[model samples]
Target: MTVLLRSSTTLAALLLLLPKTFVLGSVKLVMQNGGASQCQTLWAKHTIAVGNVCVEADQRNPEQLIVSYETRDGWKLDDAHLWIGRNISEIPFMADEPADDSKRSVQQQQHQDQPYQKQQQVDLTQFPYKKEDLAGKHENFGFVVKLQHLGYSCPDTQAFVAAAHATVTARSSIRNGNTPTLQSAWASHIEPMKKHVLQGATMINRINQWQDFNFTLVCDIKNDPPEGAPKRHFANQVPK
Candidate 1:
């Protein structure tokens, strides 16, 4: 009886110490920025690639903000730098990519915990290769990005990391009861484009008011191979 009870106690302690694991299909998100405190587990969108969607409402406003993941399509967020971890994340959409054009000095780039392989942030605004290079290529599976007032602008960042999981808090409001829909919120972030004849360097459309946020994304690379390989080189292999 003593030995059995001791074994049971040991097993219980071990289970308590185990790190929780979540499958790709199940993920929960909590946000305190929508005028109230809330946490929600996001539902996976019906697609082969890694993307998800959820609808949330903010207090003192008529509309809710649409949160979605952009693993491949819809990666751009107007002219802002594409993802987190970098100072400026503006991605490239119009320029021609050259081969062997790796930016970010090895010493300067930051590193996050596993699942998120280091050296994930590549140059987005300037291309060294063509879109044809990524034929049938898939991006990493998990990344929850929140674009604030982003629109259909040229050269958007494909992936970025937030300091933590999804959460946004803002104190300002236009309060037109706009009911921030996916299409409407996206349209609100759009900037005027240049005429075809006078296409030139990219310009930015600044928001009238400044909204501050405190959150970060922990973006994972499509490939996390061993032996210090860049994310583009391997499958989802990371240190055990």
Candidate 2:
């Protein structure tokens, strides 16, 4: 009777191990551009494996993403500020602060002495909003939001203050329909913010990875006259 009971349990377990089939479907890539797909190529180059799908892109020459759009009234963007961020780790420990010898290991000292540098790359397509969306909270601000790094000089508090002034000036210029020459000029202003105590700059215990800092910036766009401008159409610095 014990042997028979054991046999019955084994059969029940085997029955529970039956195979289940799943329906398979393929999703085609709707290439927005006629040529080879840039997103597909980037995913392939990165080999950033996802679920069961594989993507590929040109390994040698990669295309950059540039943002261009038209407004309802047919206003086209010839050029706009492409927000960028710097990898703060790009700077060497010795370069940021040479006196802190206790923290810089032997390997770090060697690396600091070398001339290796990190490249600055921007992902313009990875924008904050859908490519086609015309209305949103972000749209109201008339500025694009992005993760960017700005360059800064250490031991320079006044430089940081200057950055703030530059940012406000650029935004004001954009609103007034004046031509803004350089995007990096504005980025330089924000560079000091990363080192600013408020941004949380931390040193890693390891030697390979340098300290990392993140920053965000928004573009400004408004044409309405200021409240205090001498002319009704122009807004003066003073509030009306």
RMSD of each: 22.1, 26.5
lDDT of 2 by residue, 66-147 (tens): 2222122112222222322343332222223234455554445555653323223332344232232322112111232211
Task: Find the candidate with the highest lDDT and give its number.
Answer: 1
Candidate 2: C-alpha lDDT: 0.23
* Clashes (N, CA, C under 3 Å) per candidate: 24, 13
Q: 1-240, model 1: which lDDT tens digit per residue? A: 000101012234333443333112211223333222221222112112222222223222322222332333422111122123333333323433443324522322232121211223334334221122222222222222333333211112222221111111111111454432221011111222322321123222322211111222211112124457654523666654
Lowest lDDT block of 10, candidate 2: 159-168
Error of 1 at 31 (Å): 1.1
User: Where does model 2 exceed 4 Å of error?
Assistant: 1-115, 128-139, 142-178, 181-191, 194-240
The Cα error of candidate 1 at residue 223, in Å, is 27
Give TM per candidate: 0.18, 0.18
